[model samples]
Target: MTETIIPGTYIDVRAEGLISAGRIATGVLGIVGTASNGPVGQPVTLALPSQARTRFGLADDPRNPTDGANPLTLVRAVELAYANGASTVVAVRVAGTGKTSASYTLRNDSGQQIAALTTRVPGSWGNAVEVSLQDSEEDCLVERENVESPFNGVRYAPVVPSPRTRVRVVRGATGQAEGFDVVYRRLQSEEQVRPTAAGRFFLDATPVEAGVPAARISVRKPGGVLVDYTGDAIVYETGVPAAGTVRIDPASGELTFAAEEVPAAGAQVTATYGVGHALPTTGQVLLTTWSGDLDFADGEAPVQGDTVEVTYLLDRDSCVQVTLTNAGTVERFVGPDADFLSARINAASQLVSAEPDDLLGNQRPVNDEGLMGSGSNVHGADGANAGRDEYAAGLAALENQLVNIVVLAGQHATTHGDVLAAHLALTANSEHERIGVIGAAGSSVEDINAHGMADGRVVVVAPGIRYPDGITLASGHTAAAVAGLVASVSPQTSLTNKPLNIPDVDQDFNRGQQAQLIGGNVLTIVRKGGFRVLRGVTSEGEGMPYSAIPTRRIVDYARYGVRSAADPYIGRLNNVRVRDALKSSLDGFLTRMVDEEALTGYELDVFADRSQEIRGEVSVVMTLQPTFSIEFVLVTMFLR
Candidate 1:
């Protein structure tokens, strides 16, 4: 497939071949919940925990309590996710009722409407944003002066022009009061420097770009044709006795040659190189910020002619300078205008404007007088339909994206059926293999069983764990630790025996809690060592297949590998050649799994039915035999 840039003045281009086959990224996770601040409904991928704090402001607000079952719970869960071992996280902030963004309006000198500037997204976080402008320092105007005669006895004075020109600062002289080399242009005529047998000449100006030469050489050979060297093919060779070529460093503008490379005794060599004359560095000037008639002077302050006025804005990054020369005596408005600041921000921002793109010109309006507003509460939808309907839409947005695990910040009182529905939707109904870690609020094992959540795809845990921090994180928080523990090892690694990263709880489970754990619900209890998972069981009950986390993990790995291996052959023909190729690819992938001891064996059945092939259907049925994790050990010791 070919890639095309969207219709715009500027576009970023990337090659298609760089897109590789999709492999299940074990450490990548998807989290959905309400946040104090962040883009609502948008899936923002964050690489570092610091980025999460910056993008979705920290939840440590004194205004709100740190109770785990509230909006702030999402923040703690994300922090825990990163703390454990998630390398990349795709956090989607779900916004409910009464949330808005803060904004301001900007106007021009005539009191005419310019544009409006708003926060990157909806949240109270935008209230902290402040906008201001500062003028560029060291800006001045320099006029070129025409001298009466040659300052020195240089023959090619006007032919190459004087090496330097004196100019007067016209405006914007608000900088240090010292001489500066502002503009350095190529010399008018090449300086006639005496060349050594071998030496180097540093040209005044660095070439505008690479691979393009800006200097030329003319040699008048005694009793021979005058030779000229210019452009890329131009070369300077050493005298016939010791022949070698002189070279120019394009970037530094330095010319080098060996001593023996000097011209023969009888030859006269003249070099023509580019030069630059700069304005004062301290009291600098902008060439475009002037109006009326212009004149160049030597050491004279040339007077400005009768004209209204002029102003300019320079974008140092893009080198785009905008100058407005007044038409009449109308008042002029300058400083970081709306459009200038808008272009600067929009150039690197993903935030969208509240107004239509067409109505807002290249620049968005900034209203200094406008009040920051538009934040609201999203909890109005709570306790209505179990919050499942709200989070369902959120999960729908992440359909095509690859997310190995999905966790819902079950801070609010969500119905058991709704939690079960979210789990089934994430794993069973979805085309991708995803495991869901959900929270069961009560201590009764029957509470979990009654929810009908006994599916291999879901892991239900009970009553929250108290973190070392003062806040008591919800049961859903355990999923972060669980996901981290699972993602810490490779797909081939046995997960059953692997101990969890210390959860740091203070007490062991009571008799009733131990009874609940044995019945299949995952729980965290303080053992002799530290806080460890009592069981790795999924929501799956006694009689079902794939009851433990390891079994489910093995199936996920096998399915993920099979799909990844078969992705490359998607559009090939259904004939024996393509089928055999498919089988070979699967065989190789399965062989690695067997070698890693993740699987005992695997069988692959490629598309072979003629009737199915007529409909252009390519199918592959992979039967996997997985190596189960050792969860129980039976031994008897006899005393003689």
Candidate 2:
């Protein structure tokens, strides 16, 4: 496969509320929720509600889905936040420690596993993934000309038969042969043609090998040739067939001619002819890939047309392809077969990872489901598994993010108030200054008041909100809605009568109940014409400074702006010149804030002592007078 451009995790800056050029993002919300899929303990930024399903995956249990279940918590919470009015969200997905990944095994023809595919991250959503493999082969042909056969020397053919008969003849008297008036006798002997062990049919050029026996053979051909009787004018048997013809007996060493072709009666004749025998054919080798031969025991093995054809299965290369499907989204990966398939899938597949079994001989994975691969749906993911530790890990992951508001989805803030409170305090001390929106969802007003959360950084709301379907959710979900509302508007804007965009609440408070909830420092929402926040207040008790939501946010915003203004002068000289320039920058930013009405008035002082200047410290202190929304209006009337 070619190189793939992996999609990035961060959302587009244009879609988000962040401005990298020294401006703060005041509308970003950070949330933690349990999910069925996605990298746990990592923060992922996204703007649209649809992006949540694509990045974190859909429900774990597709057959039975729930808004409160872990499989649906993250997605539902993000959708709710967006529905309220959040433009950007930094969401972190978390699961329990004992989470598992969905996996499948692939095997070869021998029933041994060749490779395996697994989910990229641990969760039950990966169970939807499936796999398939295909075969790739080529043809192979073998010739049988020189192949060694098992029956090489045992099978042969005979050129000459046994018990052959031949007649002998006498030579002339003038020939100095041993027998001038030789006795005429018929000779009989066996001249067999045997094959060698290596399937050779011919014998060596020896005296007795070619049927020329070394016996009492006095009238043999001189030098094994008959050349016109070798100057013996009266030669008969020694003459070539051009002058006279003769036949030789294989055993008796005698020569005879046809009656019409015999020499003259008084001429000298010589018995110079010899008999020869032909060899037999034998079986030979065929091939290494295929080895067999024709039955040559009954007759001579044919030597003219002894070719054989062989065909066999050839071990060839293969290609393996894998597919990962989840929530209607599909990703396909391809690579060479066997163990090499794992590398390509791991590098390119965003939905699932892969592993190969090198010890199983790297056999090509078969296409059969039962023989090669399987899909499992045994991973666990439930919202209850995420304890406080998991949420803490999620919070840690979002610590570096530039978020304005934080919220917990589908969970009660009262259950984990200590952890959330500690996190917000730490973040505020570190200058991040993000406020958390929490709610005692599903609790009575008395229970909410009973729970003590006096931290000014946290905005606690009471009595969960209800949906259009008549289902009332917990306060934590309402907290998510409130967070979205907070992020949509400016920090200085009051949330006293802002529309929460909700259908209704679980219980609308009466005047006394509202007074009790407000007195207990809970940001209570009531239904008038539509759902709107009754009064915005922190958990901080009555008459406490910084108890208003907007007041806290405004200070945080100004602190961020002031820091942004002064951060550029850190490395410069710590003398009066640099201090004056830094003060001027702060004045310019605070004046804009005053003009925007976030502040009523302010004071500025930038100074450093001789010892402080040596240590490169430039301290700037500001007296900020924040603007507050009017809550009461009493008219003075006189008798006219």
Best by TM-score: 2
lDDT of 2 at 115: 71
Cα-based TM-score, every candidate: 0.57, 0.66
lDDT of 2 at 144: 20
Q: Name the regions of candidate 1 deviating beyond 4 angstroms.
A: 1-24, 61-63, 66-69, 105-116, 133-387, 410-430, 443-452, 491-498, 523-528, 570-577, 604-622
- Overlapping backbone residue pairs in candidate 1 total 31
Give candidate 1's TM-score: 0.57
Model 2 misplaced regions, further than 4 Å:
1-21, 59-71, 136-317, 369-377, 380-384, 609-611, 636-640
- Model 1 over residues 326-425: C-alpha lDDT tens digits? 1121111232335544554454434424232344444423323212342321211111112555576666666666777767765322353355356556
Worst 10 residues of 1 by lDDT: 152-161
Worst 10 residues of 2 by lDDT: 178-187
